[model samples]
Target: MLLPDLVRTAARRSPHAPAVRDGAATATYAELDALADRCAHALADLGVRPGDRVVLWTSKSIDTVAVMQAVLRLGAAYVPVAPSNPRPRVQCIADGCAARLVLADDDLAGLRTRPGQTLNDAAATPADCAFILYTSGSTGAPKGVSISHRNALSFVCWAAEETGLDASDRLANHAPFNFDLSVFDLYGAFLAGACVDLVPATLAFAPEALTRFLFEREITVWYSVPSALQLMTADGGLLDGDPPPALRVCVFAGEPFPIADVLRLRAAWPAVRLFNWYGPTETNVCTSYEVTAHDLTRTRPLPIGQACSGDQVWLDPPGADVGEIVVDGPTVMLGYWGQPAQDGPYRTGDFGRIGPDGNLEYVGRRDHMVKVRGHRVEPSEIEAVLATHPAVAAAAVVVVGAGLDSRIHAAVVPAGDARPTMLGLKAHCAAHLPTYMVVDAVRLVAELPRTANGKVDRAAVTALWAEAVVRG
Candidate 1:
C-alpha cells in the first residue's frame, strides 16, 4: 500500500481520535483525512497532476503534514523545504525539483476547492519517485535524494515494529520535515495509527518550552538530534524533574550523543528506552542501537548498533585509519535527482568501522578528514576528545589552509566561566589524540553554528575560520 493508504487506514480505525495537534489547533483522524482530501482537490485545481512535483514550504505544523498527505493523494511527489531555510536555498530546491505547484499556509482564501475530493488513492509502485530531499551541501552544491514510496514504506514498517509503535503511541514531531528524521516521525507514527504532536519551531529549540510541550501533550515517543537533547540535559530541573508520564521511547540521530548526556537522560527517565540511530539523509536510519541497563557508563561512546530491520551495512576496507560506509537497502534513495546514477552501491561518504561486537561505529566524514602538516586528521576525533572535557559545551573542528599543509582550527562553546585556554585545550588533545589530530588553534564561541535542521553548520564554521586567518 502507498503511504497515504496508511493515513486512510488510521482514519478508518479511529475517526474521532486525535491525529495531529498544534498549539491551539488539533485535528482528529476524520478531520485530518477530510482536510487532506480538500488539499488534494485544491492542488488539482491549481493544475497539479499525477507525478507532478509540489513544494510544501512551511514550518513544523499540522498544515504542513496535511499538505504532504494531500500531495501523495494526488499522486504528486511532495518536496518539503524547511521554512527556516534562506530564500535562495528554498528557491534552489524548488528549481531543482521542477516543482509544478508551491503551497503555503495563509493561502486559505486562495483554496477554492471542496472537501471529499481526491485525484487518486492508488499505491505508487517501487519505481515511482515519492519525494526528493535536498542535502545541505557543505563541500559544494546541494544534491537531491530521490526516494520512492515503497522505499520509505519499507523503512517505516521496520521502524514501527522495532520501536513497538502502535495506536497507543503519541509520537512527537520534533524534527523539521526537510530533515529525513521526520520520515520516521510521520510514517512510523501513521503505520501504528498513532497521534503526532507537532512541536512548534519556537518551542523546539527552547528546552523549558520543549519539556512543557512533551509532558503537557503526553508524548510517548520522542525523536530529535543529540544536540537538542544535550541542551535539555543542561537545563535546570529538566532531567531531575519527573519524566513525562507517557514517554516510552527516545530515539536520537543526526549526530553522536556524548555518553555523559546519554547517562544523564537515563538518570532523568529511567524507564524510557534510549536508542542511538545512524544514517545519512540519502538512507533513512539504516542502523540503530538500544542502550542497555549495564551500558550506562558516562565515559563510553554509544555504538551505532546493528543494521535496521531490512538493511545491510558494510564498511569499506580502504585502510587501517578509516573506511567509507556503503549501504544496500530499500531505504536507500534511488540517486540524486537530475544527476547520473552511480553503477555501484550508495557510498555514504562517512568514515566508520565494524567493532569487535559487530556494531558499526562512525569515525567522521571522509571530507571532514583534514591534513595537518603531513598527517591526516579526523576532526571528529578531536571533537570527541574535547567533549570529554567538563568545560566544553559544544565543539567543532575544521581544516583551514590554502596550500598542501593545513591547520586544525576549532570552535568551542564552553560551560561556565572556567573556560579552557587555547594552549590548555591543545595540550588536552595532544595527550588523548595522536599528534596529527591536535588542534592548531581554538576559538571560543557563544554557540556553534547550526543548519536549518539543527545539525552543526560546518560551512559557516569554515567561513569564520578562514576569515580569522585572513585577518591575522
Candidate 2:
C-alpha cells in the first residue's frame, strides 16, 4: 500500500478520533485529512507534479505534518529540512533534490488554492519514493536517502502489530521530522489508527519540561535516542517523582545505551516494556531487542536482538562472530537520492557480533576504530569504561592525531553533585584500562554537544578539543 493510504484508512475508520496533538491544538482524523488534501492542492497548483521532490523547511507542527502527507498525496516525495538548520545547509538540500518548491513557515502566505480533484491512489505504487532523508555526511556534503512506500510500510506494519498499538494509543514523537525516527512516529500511528503527540524541538533539551509534557499528554508509546532518556532520568527527576502510569512502551535507538543507565531505568520503570532498536537511516529499525529483567544483570552493552519482520541481517566475512553488519529487506532504502541505486544488501559500516544467545551485539563503527601505536582501539570501548565511573553521567572518546603521534582524548559530562577531576578520572582509567587505552586529555562539560537527531556530535566535540589545545 502507498504511504498516504494509511492516513486515509484511519480517517475512514475513525474520522472523529484525535490524529495529531501540537501543544493546545489537536487535529481529528477528518480534519488532518482535509488539511493534507488542501496542502496537496496548493502544492499541485505550484507545479509540484507527480514524482517531483519538494523541500519542507519548517519546525515540528501540525502544519508540517500536513505538508508531509500532502506531498505523498500528490504522488511526490517530501524532503524535510529541520528549521534549526542553517540557511546554507537548507539551500544545499534544496539544490541536491532540485526541489520543485520550498515550503517554509511564512512562505505559505498568499497560497490560495481550492481543494483539487484527488489523484487516483492506485497511480502510486509501493515502489514510488515516499521521502528523502538526508544524513550529515562526514565529507562536508549531505547525502539524501531515498525511502519508498514499501520500505516504510515494511517496518510500520510490523511495528504497529508487534507493539499492539490501536486507536486508543497515543505515540510521543520526540525526533525531528528530518530524522528517520519520525517515520515510525507519523506513519505507524496512522497505520494503527492512533494519535501522535508532536514534541517540539525546543522542549528536547529541557528534560524536566519534556517529562512533564509526556505525563500531561498521557502518552502511551515513547521513542527517542538513549541520551534523551538518560537526561530525563538523571537531571529531569523522572524517577524522583511518581511513575507515568500511562507509559506502556519505551523504544530507544540512534546510539548505544550505557548498560548502567539501562539498569537504573529498568529499576525505576519495572512494568514498562523497554526495547532497544538498531538501524541506520538507510534502513529503519532492521533489528530490535526487548529488554528483559535478566538483561539488567548485563555488565556490557545491550544486544541489538534479532531482525525485524520482513528484514534480513548478516555479518560480512561469513562465520566470523564480529564483522560489518549488512542488511537486506523491503525496508532498505532504494538508494541515495539522485545517485545510482545499490543492489543487494546494504553494507552498513557498523560492526557487530552474534552473541551465544543468538542476539547481535554492536561493536563501534569500523572507521571509528583508530590505530594508536599499532594497537587497534575502538572509541566505544574506552567510552564504555568511562561511563561505568559513578561520577560520570556520559563520556565520549576521540582520537586527536594520526600515526604514532595519535592520542585518545576523553570528554565527560559529570553526574549530579559529582565534580570529577581530571586526575580522578585518569586514575580511575589506570585501574580499569591498559596504559595505551588511557586517555591523554580529559575535559568536563555540563553536557555533550548533540546533533539535530540527538546523537553525540563527534565532529563538534573534536573541534572543541582542538580549540582548547590552541588556547592552552
Candidate 3:
C-alpha cells in the first residue's frame, strides 16, 4: 500500500484520534484525512498528472505533512527541498527531478521561473512516481533518487511491524521532509495509525524547546540526529527533572554517535531503547542495531546492527576492514533519476565493515578521509575524540588553514562551565593520535551549523575557515 492507504486506514480506525501536532495547531485523524483529500483535489485541479514531479520547498509543519500525503495520493512524485537550503541548491534539486510543480511558503510561493504550475489542491494517484529524494554529491553533483509507491509501501510496512509502533506511539517528526528520516515519521506514523508531532525546523536545534515539546506532548518515539541528542544530553539539562512521560524508543541516524555519549545517555535513560541506524538517503535505513547494555561496552566498537526486516546489506571487496557499503532491497532507490545505469550493486560512498559478530558498523565516508602532511586522517577519528571529552557538547572536524598542505581544524561546541582549553584538547589528541592527525586549531563555538537533514554543515565550517584567514 502507498502512503494514502495508511492515511485512509487511520481515518477509518480512529478518526477522532489526534493525528498531527504542530505548535498550537493540531489535527485529528479525520481532519488530517480531509485536509489531504482537499489538497489532493486541489492538485488535480492544477493539472498535475501521474508520475509528475513536484518539489516541496517548505519548513516542517502539520501542513507540510498534509502536502506530502496529498502529492502521493494524486500519484505525483514529491521532491522535497528544505527551506534552509540555498536558492541555488534548491533550484538544482528541482531541476534534477524535472519537477512539474513547486510548492513553497509565502516567501517562495510566487516563484514562476520554473515551468510547473503551482499546486492549489491535491489529486489522486495512478501509482506512478511517489517521490524523488536527492542525496549529497561526494563527486560534486547530487543525484536524484526515484522511489516508487511499491518501494515506499514495502519499507513503511516493514518499519511499523519491526518497531512495534501502534496508535499509541507519538512519533516526533524532527527530520525535514526532504530527509529520508521523515519517512519513518510520516509513513510509519500513518501505517501504525499513530500521532506525529511536527517540530518546526527552527525549534529542532533548541534543546530546551525540544525537551519541553516532547514532555508536554508525551512523545513516545524520538527520532533525530545524534548531535541533537548530544546537545540535549549535555547542555539542556533535559533529564534533570522528571523524564519525558512517554519516551520509549530513541532512534538516531544521519551521522555517527559517540560511543562515550551513547554510554552517558544510556545511564541517564535506562528504560529508553536506543538504536543506531546506518544508511544513506539513497537507501532509507537499510540497517539498524538496537544498543543493548551488553553491546554498549562490549570493548569492540558498536555495530550499526543487523539489516532491517527484509533488507540485504554487505560490504564491497569482502573481508576488507573498510569498504563502500552496498544495500539491495525494496528500500533502495531506483537509481539516480537521470544518470546512466551502471551494472551490479548500489555502492554507498559511506565506508563500513561487517563486525566479527556479522553486524555492520560505519567507519567514515570514503571521501571524508583526507591526507594531512602525507598522513591520511579521518575527520570522524578526531571528532570522536573530541566528543568523549566532558567539555565538548558537539564537534566537527574540517580541513582548514589554506595551502595545498591544509591543516586540520576543529569547531567545537563546549558544554556549560566546562570550557576545555584548545591547547588541552590538542594535547589530548596528541596523546591518542599521531602528530599529523592533531587539529591545528580548535575554535570553540556555541554550536556548529547543520544542514536541513541535521548533519553538520562541513561546507559552512570550511567557509568560516576562509573568513578567519581573510580577517587575520
Candidate 4:
C-alpha cells in the first residue's frame, strides 16, 4: 500500500474519529483527510509532481502533518529539516536533496484554504520515495536519508501489528517530524486508526510539562529516546504524585537506557510493556526487544533484540564477541539523498553481539571508542558504570582533546537532591572501570544535553565543558 493510503484507509474506517492533537488544536480523520486534499491541490498548483522532493521546513503541528500527507498524496517526497534551522541551513538541505520546493508555515496555511480542485492521489508504488529525513548534523552537515514507501511501511506495519494498536490507543509523538521516530507516530498510528498526540518542542526537555502531558493526555503508547523518560521520572516526579494507569507501552530508542533506570521503571510500571527499538535513521527500527522481567536481573545493558520489520540483523565477523551490526532487508533506506545507492547489506557503524539468549546486545557505536592516554577507551563503558551509581540519574563520558593531550571528562545528572560528589563518581568509575578509563574531571548538570533527535549530544557536552574551562 502507498504511504498516503494509511490516512485514506483510516479516514474511511473512522472519519469522525480523533486523528491528531497538538496543544488546543485537534483534527478528526475527516478533517485531516480534507486538509490533505486541499494541501495536495496547493502543491500541485505550485508545480510539484511525482518523483519530486519538497522540503517541509515547519514545526510539528497538525498542519505540518497534513502537509506531509499532501506531499505523499502527490507522489512527491518531502525532505524534513528542523524548523529551528536558519534559512541558509534549510536552503542547503533543500539544495542537497534537490528539492522542488521548500514550504514553510505560511505556504500551507495560505494556500490550502484557497485551494481549487480535489487533486487525485498520485499513482505511487511501494518503491517510490516517501520522504527524506536528515541526520542531526552534530559532526558536520546533515545528510538526508532517503526512505522509500516500502522501506517505511515495512516498519510501520510491523509496529501496528506487534502493538495491537487500534482506534482507542493514544500514541504520543515526542519526536519532531525531522526525526525518523516520527514515522511510526504518523503512519503507524494512522495505519491502526489511532489518535496521535503531538507533543510540542517546548515540552521536549521540560520534564514537569512532559510528565503532566503523559497523565493528562492519557498516553497509552510513548516513543522517544531514553533521556526524555529519565528526565520526566527523575526531576518531574512522573510516578511520585499519581498513578499513570493509561500508559501501557513505553518505546525507547536513539540511545541506551541505563539498566538501573530500567529496573526502577519496570518496578514502578510493571504492567507497562517496554521495548528497546534499535536502528539508525537509515534503517528505521530494524530490531526490537520487548522488555522481559528477566532483563531487569541482567547487569549488562539491554539487548536490542532480534530483527523485525522483515530485516535480517547480524554482527559482522560472524562468531566474534562483538562486531559492527549489519542489516539487509526492506526497511533499509534506498540510499543517502544525492549519494550513491546502497548496493547491498548496510553496515551499521554500531557494534553489537548476539547474547546467550540469542538477542543482539548493543556494544556501543564503532565511533565511540577513543584513545585516552594511548589506552583504548569506550566512553559508554564509563557511562554505563556511572549509571549504576545510586545518586546518578544519568551520565555521559566525552574525550576533551586530541592524542596524548586528550582527557576523559564526565558529565552527570544527579538523582533528585542526592547529588553524587565529583570525587564519589570518580571513585565509582575507578572501582568499576580500568584506571585509564577513569575520568579526569566530572561536572554535574540538571540534565545532559540532547540533540534534535533526543539522544545525548556528546559534541554539545564537549563544547559546554570546553567553554567552562576557557572561562576558568
Candidate 5:
C-alpha cells in the first residue's frame, strides 16, 4: 500500500477519531481527510502536478500535517523544512529538489480552495518517491535522501504491528517534521488509526514544559533523540513527578543513550516498555532492542538488536566479527537525491559487530575513527568508558592537532550536582582504556553542542576546545 492510503484507511474506519492534535487545535480523521483534499486542489491550481516536488516549510501543526497529506494525495513528493532552519538551508533544499512550489504556514490561510471532486488513490505507486529528507553532508551542503513509498511503509507497517499500536494509542511527535524520526511518529500512528500529539519546537528544549505536556496530552508512545529524553529526566525532574500511567512505550534513537541515563530511566519507570532504536536517516530504524532488567546492568552500550520485519542487516566482510553495517531490504532508501542509483546493499558507513548473543553491537561510525600516535582509536570506546563515571552525564572525544602533535581531547557534561575534575576523570579513564587511548585533555561543560537534529556537533565541540586553548 502507498503512504497516503494509511490515512485514507484510518479515515474510513474511524472518521470521528482524533487523528492529530497540535496545541489547542485538533483534527479528526474525517476533517484531516477533507483538509487534505482541499489542499491538494489548491496545489493543483498552483501548477503542482503528479511527480512534482513541493516544499512544506512550516512549524509543527495540524496544518503542516494536512499539507503533507495533500502532497501525497496529488502523487507529489513533499520535502519538509523545519521552521527553525535558516532561509538559506530552505532555499538549498528547494533548489536541490527542483520544487514546483513552496508552502509555508502563511499558505494555510488560503488553502481552502475548491475541493477536488475525485480522489485518485493510485496517483502514486509503491515505487514512487514518497519524500526527500536532507541530512548534513561533510562538504557543507545538505544531501537529500530520497525514500520511496515502499521504503517507508516497510518500517511503518512493522512498527505498528510490533508495538501493537491501535486507535487508543496516543503517540508523541517529538522530532521536527524535517527529521526522519518524525516519519515513524506520523505514519506509524496513521497506519494504526492512532492519534499523534505534535510537540511544538518552542517546547522541545523546555524540558519542564515538555514533561508536563506529555502527561497533559496523555502520551502513550514517546519517541525522540536520546538527548531529549536525558534532558527531560535530568533537568525536568521527570522521575520526581508522579508516574504517567498512560505512557506505555518509550523509544529513543538518533544517538546513543548514555548508559547511566538509561539506567536511571529504567529505575524511574520500570513498568514502561523502553526501546533503543538504531539506524541512520537513510534507513528508518533497521534495528531495535527492547530494554530488559539485565540491560540496565550493562556498562557498555546496548546492542541495536536484530533487523525489523521486511529488513535485512549484515556486516560487510561477513566473516569478520566487526565491520561496516550493510542494509538490504524494502526499507532501504532509493538513494541520495541527484545521486546515481546504487545496487546491492546500502553501506551505512557505521561500524558494528554481531555479539555472542547474536545482537548487532554498534561500534561507532567508520569515519569517526581517528589515528593518534600511529594507533587507530574509536572515540565511542573512550566516550563509553567516561559515561560510566557517576559524575559524567555525557562525554564526547575529539581528536585535535596533526601527526606527532595530534591528541585526543574529551569534553564532559556533569550529571546532577556532581562536579567532575579533569584529573579524576583521567584516572577513571586510566582504569578502563589503554594509556594511548586515554585523552590528553578533559574539559567539563554545562552541555554538549548539538546540531539541529540533536546529534553531537563534533566540529562545534572542537571549536569550543580550540577557544579554551586560546584563552589559556
Candidate 6:
C-alpha cells in the first residue's frame, strides 16, 4: 500500500477524528483528507504531474503537512526544506532536485480556491519515490536521500506497531518536517487515526513552552532528538510536578543522549519507556534500544542495541573487530538523488562493534560527518563554502564538544594580507549553508597544518581553534 493510504484508511475509520493540531488550529481526518485532495488539484492546476518533484519550503505547520499529503497523492515526491534554511541554500536544494514547483504561504492558502471537492488518489505504487531528503554532502553540495513509498511504510508500520499506537493516542511532533524523525510523528499517527500536535517554531527551543505543550496536549507518544528531551526535562521541569498520565512512550534519536541525562530521565519517569534509536538519514532508524533500569549502573553512553524495523544491520569486514556499520533492507534508501539505484548493501560511514551483551554499540565516526543540533553536517561542506571567500586562502572546519551540544569551529588562512573577519565569514556562510551547518567560531591562521601525506590535518586545525580565546 502507498503511504497516502494510511491517512485515507484512517479517515475511513474515523472521519471526524482530530488528525493534526497546531496551536489553536486543528484538522479532523476528514478535513485533512479533503484539504489534501484540494491541494492536489491546486498543484495539478499549477502544472505539477506524476513523477515530478515539488519542494515544500516552509515552517512545520498543518498546511505543510497537508501539502506533503497533497504531493504524494499526485504521484510526486515532496522535498522538505527546513524553515531555518537561508534563501540561497533553499534555492540550491530546489535547483539540485530540479523541482517542478516550490510551495510557500500563498501556495498553501491557494488550496481554498478549489473548494472542498475531493480529487481521486493518483495511480501510484509502493516503489514510487515518496520523498527526497537532502542532507549535508562531503562534496560541498547537499545530498538528496531518496525514500520510496515502500521504504517509508516499512519503518512507519514498524513504528506504529512497536509503540502500539491507537486512535486514542496523541503524538507530539517535536522534530521539524525536514528531519526523518517526523516520519513516525506524522505517518504513524495517521496510520492509527491518532492526533499529532505540532510544536510551534518560536517555542521549539523554549524549555518551559515545550514541556507545557507535552502535558497540555495530552501527548501519549513523543519522538525527537536527544537534545530536545534534554532541554525539556532538565531545564523545562518536565518531571518536576508529576508525570503526565497520558505520556507513556518517549523516543530519542539523531545523536547519542548523555548518560547522566538519560539516567535522570529514567529516575523521574520510571514507568515511561525511554528508547535510544540509532541510524543515519539513509536508513530510517535501522536499530532501536529500549532503556532499562540496568542502564543506570553504566558509566558510559548507552548501546545503540539490536536492529529493528525489518532492517539487516551489522558491522562490515567480517567479524574480526569493530567495522563500519552496513544496512540492507527495505528501509534503506533507494539511492541518492542524481545517482544510480543502490542495488547492494549500503555502507554506513559510522563504525560500530558488538558489545558483551551482543548489542551493536557505536564507535567514533570513520569520516567527518557529524550531527549538530540533530542535523547531519559535513565539515567539508562548510569548509568548501568558506574556501570560496576571496579573503581566505584556505579553510578547514572541525566539530567541538561532544554529542548534540557540540559547536563547529573553523580555521582559515588569510589570503596574502587580506584578513577575513569572523562576521564576514559568518555572513558568507549564512548566505550559503543552513544555520546548523554554519561555523560557530572562526579563527585566522597563516597556514593549516598538514601531515607527510600532504593532507590537511583536521585534528591540528581543531587544536589551533582550541587555542583561541579570541575570535578572528
Q: Which one is best on TM-score?
A: 5
| Local accuracy by lDDT, each model | 0.81, 0.88, 0.78, 0.88, 0.87, 0.83
lDDT of 2 by residue, 1-472 (tens): 7889988889999999999999999999988888788777778778988899999888888888888888898889999988888889989999999999988877653332455444454268899899999987777899999999999999998888877898899999999998989988998899988999999898987899988987999999999999999988877888887779899999999999888898888878888989999999999999989997888778766899999958999999889867899999999899998889968899999989988788999988987888997888888878888888889999988999888999889889988889888888888888888888888889998889988788998999999899998999
The stretch of ten residues in a row with the least summed lDDT in candidate 6 is: 446-455
C-alpha RMSD for every candidate: 2.2, 1.7, 4.4, 1.7, 1.3, 11.5
Off by over 4 Å in 1: 117-123, 298-300, 318-321, 341-344, 402-405, 466-472
Tell me the tens digit of each residue's lDDT in model 4 across 393-471.
Answer: 8888999998889999989888878879878887888888888888888899877887777788888899989998999
Q: Over all chains combined, what TM-score does candidate 5 have? A: 0.97
Q: Can you give the TM-score per candidate against the true fold?
A: 0.93, 0.96, 0.89, 0.96, 0.97, 0.80
Candidate 3's residue-wise lDDT over 1-472, tens digit each?
A: 5567787888888999988988888899888777776676666667767778888888876666777777777777788888877889888888887777777875232221223332333344423458888877757777777776666766777777767899999999988877788888888888888988898888888888888877888899999998888777766777687667789998898898877778777777888888888778677778888887775566445678888846788888887888778888777666678886423456887888777888887877877888877677789878877777778877899986435668998998887778889788998888777888888888888788887667889999888877888999
TM-score, candidate 2, is 0.96
For candidate 1, the lDDT comes to 0.81
Q: Quote the positional error of residue 232 for candidate 2 in Å.
A: 1.3
The 10-residue segment with the lowest total lDDT in model 3: 109-118
Candidate 2 wrongly placed segments (more than 4 Å)? 109-122, 421-434
Best of the two (1, 6) by TM-score:
1
- Tens digit per residue, CA lDDT, model 6, 44-70: 999989999999988888888988999
Provide backbone clash counts, one per model: 0, 0, 14, 0, 0, 0
Superposed Cα deviation of residue 74, candidate 6 (Å): 0.7
User: What residue pairs are clashing in model 4?
Assistant: none
Question: Could you tell me the lDDT of residue 244 within candidate 1?
Answer: 79
Q: Where does candidate 4 stray beyond 4 Å?
A: 115-118, 137-139
Question: Model 1 misses residue 308 by how many Å?
Answer: 0.7
Q: Residue-wise lDDT of candidate 1 within 286-402, one digit each (tens)?
A: 989988776765354678888885788887874454588888877878778887753456788988876666677788888777677778788887888888777887799998883
